[model samples]
Target: MQPSSSPSKFDNMPGDIERRPSVEEALDHEPLEKGWWYKPHVLKLNFLMLAPFVTMAAWGFDISMTNSLQSLEAFNERFDHPSGARLGFYGASTQLGGAFTIFVAPFIIQKLGRRAMCLIGSSIIIGMSIMQTFALNFNMFVAAKLLLGFGSTGVQIAAPVLITELAHPRQRERITAMYNTTIYVGLIAGAWIAFGTQDIPGDRSWQIPTILQVVLPAYQVLTIFLCPESPRWLVAKGQEEKARKILVKYHGGGQETPLVRAEMEAIMAGIEADATRIRFNKTDISALLSHKGNLHRILIATVVAVGSQCTGSGLISAYLPQILDNVGMTSTREKTLINGIINIWTWIIGLGAGYVIPKLSKRSLFLFSTSGMILTFVVWTALSAVYTQQGGYSYGIGVVAMMFIYNAFYGMCWLPLVVAYPLELATTKQRGILFSWMFFCLSMSTFAVNYINPIGLENIGWRYYIITIVFTLLILCLIYFFFVETKGLSLEEVATVFDGRENYDAAVSAVHAVEVKQAGEPEEQHVERKDER
Candidate 1:
């Protein structure tokens, strides 16, 4: 099939088309059973298959390392560095590896099923763990981290797609949140482990954290091996019967055959329908940019992805130990404890937001969350500087207040919302490429920030957050000015919105009209994710 170039599609689909499912019609349907959460077999399978995602504990392996020695002077002496430059280099390199992963992921996803991809990711992490545990020098350690970054990319790309495919429509956001939550769980786990082990005076003390990294991925591998393949992947591979069996087993009511069949049929229909209208070679970045609407969606996705990392999460996380020491939380153990707790609790908040997200209009959530981040940056920037400069107890309180609110708001709003928006906004035909470009932009932005944060600290001190604050404000303004609310809208309906000739209300009306004929069921059907579909 010839790839649909950008200009043709963009010319065909203009903005200003308003399209939404009828609230009443949507309300009339009963919620999909939340039984998957309670189903022991399915839950077991989910946990196992998702192990690679949960194994993100490695990201925090360096948290306590920063806190190992007493003061920055002491840390510098032990590491034989006048500054934390070595550590900063390590972090930036790791994130740079993530950027490489984004460039390679589309082909990887196409060639390998989600399960295989996840397993391979876990294996890469495991190998990197060994490399880290046995590292003889700085270069080896950095290389190990780079490998971990690559492995982590596999998990990052596959986990959301897998969870979205397996989860009931109502629970989609929650499941995705669970994926993020597991990442924090790993972080918290790593922190606690680091604290528990950092006191050892031997050269191998750091090895404890590196060695511990192996456990999560190891566990993930053992557990995931027993889980069923993604039904969507199964269908894609022409294993319809096996896909139905697995779907029925996990989806409850023991009578999911019909639902599975319906889902499969819908998926096939959707594929056929989409194929007839749009064609693209997955590898061609230019093909992705060919459609005006597709081009616009890619831009939006890229902006959102880049904006996510610019929020200063990486800055705070990388510098947590340093920041904590500045605030009189001098005990490495205490700092580790606090770090662990923050990661865990923030994850809980993210998970909570996910639970309620499906009910909110995507527009409302996006606006609210984007605004919340801007507010957080404002407060955090002010308080972080005050705490850093003034030696007042009130300033300390301000720092804590800002950190707490920042974590809460970030977890609840941006974490899952950013991811969900891109996936929902893109047409299936372009989903992989759009997401690839999104992650690519994210990795690039993240690497840039990681590299620059240290420079910011050395040159500007705590005032560096001001840069992020400006970006945060722009994020909200951009959402308000350029983005459209895409809540519960079908892809076709969303496509109709970008045809700029129509007025906003008129476009929406057109979307409403197109949706009845073109939109069949929500994309949550049991076998809906199958390859054919």
Candidate 2:
């Protein structure tokens, strides 16, 4: 029952090592299915998962506030009607703040636990929200935005990694799906709040929505303490008993079960064999680049991170109101209303995608989503050209309709899989680097898109969609050629997809042995999260 501080037991299996069933094939399903919803401990774990879900809402609110505020006359007047680069800089500054965190993030992830990062992120954003609400000048407002990016980027970096590590086996895919989608919920809240207060006479029109930005980050702060740190992180830090008890509650549903032991064994084997650990240094980076498998994982991480923004969603996210203006839908109330409606639509589509996510392979979903977007953008861009040249209201309206279609296709897969796919790809040893790099790419691409989008629309009109159209097509080719499917595997088992069949056989064999031999052993702790609640 000692922690797996030593190398994996199966490194030198006697005689010929036998191939073994994967965690997916060996998983005990009957116990997990019986009254799953009604189980109290299980119910509590689900509630705790909400901590990460709300973090994205904080991000969504910022995006919505940016997009909505740009359309507001009062906000424009207050900021002296920023246009071109000044306007672009305002939206892109947050990503600049995010880029600043890239190097230090790995050190923090190594030392502090995941929950600590989440808490720290939420606390930072709360102060920035207040700073933004009462800004004395545009300079003060941009400063708030720069820091808001820093805070929100911290939350974004940790939240999905937390979800991928902490979610129940049955719930991981769907929970991760729902996590990113919460941004749309935050979007809806920000959009409607701004819309609701738009008619007010003065500064309060923008101030109300800006100040209310603290809502979700504050909620994350209050609830994050309820969330357990990642069990995988615990085991790597040599706290196996605490890790075991966490798995027992969330993975085993209270008691020590075969499934829980299998997961723990697999995790230990992964840490031991793959050098997954609590510390990071130059060596981890070397290891990350040393293998073709790890290189492939990094490649996919880049695609997902950059692709999420490049698929034209970034333009809509930062410049939807301008997009509306481009297509001749110029009324402030109508623009904000359309923005609010699109948020609701994307949220609904996001929830629907959750059920479908569990059913499709990751490769299949990425391909389908990208293809759908390519088609939507082609027609969307063409319609915008018509609007620009002919000046027909129907052409403008058609362009608006295409945004809805584009979001639906994007929502089906990219919405959720951006973080989940990249996290799943990285070997545990390289998770921190790949996660940081993924977000770094995301922030930079989003910054580039957000910064360039308004200028492109202003200078070139409808032609801006052409750039994302070309980028998204390249993304689709990458998915078809390079992406690996990780649909049915447990988190530990996912390493085998990158590490090869030899390590796969050893890891799976160890899990089976542990599950059989340790199924009857007494746990050091059990159902403790119940008390946490």
Candidate 3:
């Protein structure tokens, strides 16, 4: 179990005859000074990073629109007075499609690359939105829902990986956090659109909002092509020169700077280490399953992914108006207006959280969020129970207020971390597959919650809060015990956290060797080191 100084075994697998240069041999390159963020290339690179968020915003619009659609009289009338149970299935369909998509994503992402996968996914979303707009029956609409889910899963798997790989190490958290926060923008758009259009006569009421879902994805498809493919992905494919060029352009001030060389070496070293441990082929599940440290990663990621959906936020987002109705805000107009306001507030809070994330530790933030959710659910449950028993506006208002508070806390804690943590945890070689698995967990939990929330609301009412309270408490315990701190580490460096402290030290040493080698230092003094193995 001792760490090896040299690359892992998979680095030299049979038929891998292509001779790639070691980090020291690859370049004669200056350390990029601090404040690289102010450079022109970095500024443009930051702007391009927003493409994934645009895709996510479209997905968010669909989700919030579904919640609004359930309350729209025109939609209900046009679709033949569909029951809440059926609406739940409609809500769950996207997740069901997403679950199926994850199994296929690893192959697609490998063969086509991250940019292509996102393009394909965004195209599917555009098509599905059109189909939903013109659907003649509930069945067709359901089919559109399923297809959109499949499409968005592609974007979900690729977007985070793309942004994570493309980002400068110093800004990765802020970039990913901002990506997560964009969902609220879509939610707010969907909410206000639904609110404004709900009074229109005939099918156009729901149709207008459904059709508007195409705008963001259309923008995404147009702009995604302009963004570069992941540099890590490029290296794994043995296009090191291309990867290096991208690093220089975006991260190294258009030169093969020392910072770029160190980063390239760090990435290559991690990939080599991962290759030694796991099969390069996407189909080799056994390799991924048996790889050292991967199981721990999978468990942590699965818990975080599934936990985000099942901890009652899915219930809130998918059925907000219904929950409002349960709490005595029975007017459709009133409910829609309140939902619109809530979406705006959630977006504002989420944007604030994104800005502050780099200052907080992952473990502390997750624990704080889950703790707040538990308390909010307790208060909400109490108010809801009272509202259900004694017909009073005070308890009802309290219930509404608690829901807003719960969303605010959830926005601050869970929303930003879910995407960033998994990307940080998995190494480049396993990132695509890891994201697929994470989304698989997400889709499964989303399916279960979306399907059950309506039924639970009907049968038990306030008692549903009890289920979320228990789940939130359980998540709190899991985060405390299992989640590792990953703040301020490069994605490659984060790999060592699971592998071992010795392995981490080895990675640092490898990067340091490159730094010293570039600085004209004595090889004996700086490069020579023990294998530990």
Among the numbered candidates, top TM-score falls to 2
List clashing residue pairs in candidate 3: 10-276, 30-258
Worst-scoring 10-residue span by lDDT in model 2:
524-533
Q: After superposition, how far is residue 137 of candidate 1 from its true place, in Å?
A: 1.0
Ranking by TM-score: 2, 3, 1
Highest lDDT against the true fold, candidate: 3
The segments of candidate 1 whose C-alpha lies over 4 angstroms from its true place after superposition are 1-49, 52-78, 82-85, 234-242, 252-258, 276-283, 325-334, 384-390, 427-429, 482-533
lDDT for each residue of candidate 2 in 1-533, tens digit (9 for 90 to 100)? 11113456555444232323333544544465456677787788888988877888889889899889987788989989988999899989899888776776766765787777778878888899899989988889999999888878887888788788877777787788778888898899999998999999889999999989888888888889789988888876779899999989886778877567557766776665574443345764555466677678778898898999888988888888788888889899889899999889988998799767878888988999899999999999999998888899999889889999999999888887786778887655567667888888889988898888889999998787888888888999998999988887777667777666565555545554454445543333321111100
Per-residue lDDT of 1-533 in model 3, one digit per residue for the tens?
22223354332233212222333333222343566567788888888877776767887898889889988999998888765688789889999989988767877887789888888888999999999999999999999999999999999999889999998766778988878778888888998899899889989999999999888888888898788889998988889889989999998768876567667867866776554333345645565666568888999989988898999899879988778888788888988888888888888888899888988887898888889888999999999998888879999889889979999999997888788888889888678888899999999999999999988998899998898889878888888999999776677668878875554445545544544545666545422222322
Q: Write the per-residue lDDT of candidate 1 for residues 1-533, one digit (tens) a residue.
A: 22332222112333333333232233234344664466575566556555544544444443333333222232334446534565566657666777777656666665566667677777887998888777776677778878787787766676566655565443555565455555566566666766666656665556776677777677766665565665655654456678767766665335553444344443332332232122234655455455566666766787788777887777666667656655666665666677767777787887788777766676666677767766877876676677777676677667656776778877776776666677766544445556667777877887787778776776776677788888878777777766777655433335445533133233333333343335564433312112210
- Model 1 accuracy (lDDT, Cα): 0.60
Better of 2 and 3 by lDDT: 3
- Cα TM-score per model: 0.79, 0.91, 0.90
